[model samples]
Target: METAVADRKDTLDVEDLAELCRALGHPARVRILEFLKKMDKCICGTIVDSLPLAQSTVSQHLKQLKSAGLVKGEIEGPRTCYCLDRERLDQFKQYVANL
Candidate 1:
């Protein structure tokens, strides 16, 4: 029973890490993150204008980034503001270093 519990916990951790990695699997998502890093904060429309991709494409990438916990989004009335989750990114960096 103890071993089963340990295995389950390990599985969950692996899944979580894998999900984050998968979220970053696209080049567009990486570019979006880079763009966000340069700004204090941004909205979806601004990101769409900066990138060559269409608005819908940028939105998809933003969705993935937000889902990964690498980006934080706040609604400002009609618009959703976005910024990098620096702490989470730092944690991911440390995880890679340890690996």
Candidate 2:
């Protein structure tokens, strides 16, 4: 229904929505984002302890989020610190707001 607004600009196709939704479709992913948002930034170990998911599973979800340009993680020592990609997130916010 809200897609009518999107139609006026660049039409958002299923692939685009799928990528966005896929990155956000899981409860674990949502939790991860929420935690990252609250903490501002956290390491892999931090996110692992914050949720019940295994380290590998959390890493997979993080990868998906990164691929969607919703999150970013940088390697530092043996751990990777993760945070929201604010610029990309703002783009997403603008897209939704316009829609």
Candidate 3:
């Protein structure tokens, strides 16, 4: 293996925060989080009922959550279920605590 020099400076703690914050930047996502937090877990279509936005819009927000690792989704036959990723949430919280 070859040794490599590492940068001693230039860091952005906001990378993770930026990803998460961007995913949550929309009002739809904020509502989705609230709904999921209340139920703790829910089917994909179930999220549509809680928000005034279109189902497709809600799906996009869910996609953002998935990308941010804030939510986990899996197919169940013809439906999809979503639930919080507690690990990521805890990690993010710890990041905030350190700041």
Candidate 4:
């Protein structure tokens, strides 16, 4: 049936969803996402200040999130401003619901 085929197509799209999951596998990354969700955008130093992590650790987590397309970063002068990619976050939620 067409419905079954469509379901198959969605299943085939799991690779990206899996990458998202891996990015979120760490507790620190999840917390980073939650923090970003609350703010419009913030620099890496602000994120470091909010968490117990060192700046470099926080930067690494942000990098992973950005790589997974769950976060977006824009360079502003000396800092990189970070925020949740709401569309991708929604897509991740949809993927989980489908599973």
Candidate 5:
């Protein structure tokens, strides 16, 4: 017999979903994601300027998002450029939709 969509464990990685959810738990993170979505790539300072949060706080949020695989960052000279990991974001969306 076929299992229901919600009961199919193979449909999505629960742990990954949980991590992504946690990464997006904060409003700052969500706004950062939205900003990254609009721009092809941005530096840490640019993101900090866009939000009212301090540079260190924004960095922390970026770190959490990066750890969750939702964002990608590359070291460029003295700054780090960031962009959304579209593939991972899409996967997370799919996982949520599957639930």
Candidate 6:
């Protein structure tokens, strides 16, 4: 579900923040974010290699992050390179700070 926040450079609204929190609710998803932060960029196989979860499970977590706009993916040849959306994450932090 796209939101006005997705198109704007401003902060996320109440609903968007709630959705982002839910997307980050899972521990596995948190771990995936941490792993991605350390890498310059990563592919699905690399993420699966770093985590204990199965490839499919990791993919699900990635999907959640991507959908939430926390991460961005670009297809490169046979794999998709994933990276943290640092600006959006910083915006999330600011939103949480005000709360």
| Number of the top-ranking candidate, with lDDT as the measure | 5
Comparing 2 and 6 by TM-score, which wins?
A: 6
Model 6 stretches with alpha carbons more than 4 Å out = 1-12
Write down the worst ten-residue block by lDDT for model 4: 9-18
What does candidate 3's lDDT look like per residue over 1-93, in tens digits? 122222221145567767777877888887887777788889999998878888998888899998999899989999999998878878778
Residue lDDT tens for model 5, 7-89: 57664587778889999999999999999999979999999999998899999999999999999999999999999999999
lDDT of 2 by residue, 1-99 (tens): 568777754545445656777788899988888888888889989899988888899899999999998899999999899998878767666666755
Better of 2 and 5 by lDDT: 5
Q: State the RMSD for candidate 2.
A: 4.3
Q: After TM-score superposition, what is the CA distance of residue 73 in candidate 4 from its true location, in Å?
A: 0.6
lDDT of 5: 0.93
Residue 22 Cα positional deviation in candidate 4, in Å, after optimal superposition: 0.4
Show where candidate 4 strays beyond 4 Å. Answer: 1-11
Q: Clashing pairs in model 5?
A: none
Which regions of candidate 5 deviate over 4 angstroms? 1-12
Prediction 6 global C-alpha lDDT: 0.85
The number of clashing residue pairs in each candidate reads 0, 0, 0, 0, 0, 0
Candidate 6 clashes between residue pairs 3 or more apart in a chain or in different chains: none
> What is each predicted model's overall lDDT from 0 to 1?
0.85, 0.82, 0.81, 0.92, 0.93, 0.85
Clashing pairs in 2: none
TM-score of each: 0.82, 0.80, 0.82, 0.87, 0.88, 0.83
lDDT of 1 at 84: 94
**Candidate 3 Cα deviation (angstroms), residue 95:** 1.8
Q: Which residue runs does candidate 1 get wrong by more than 4 Å?
A: 1-10
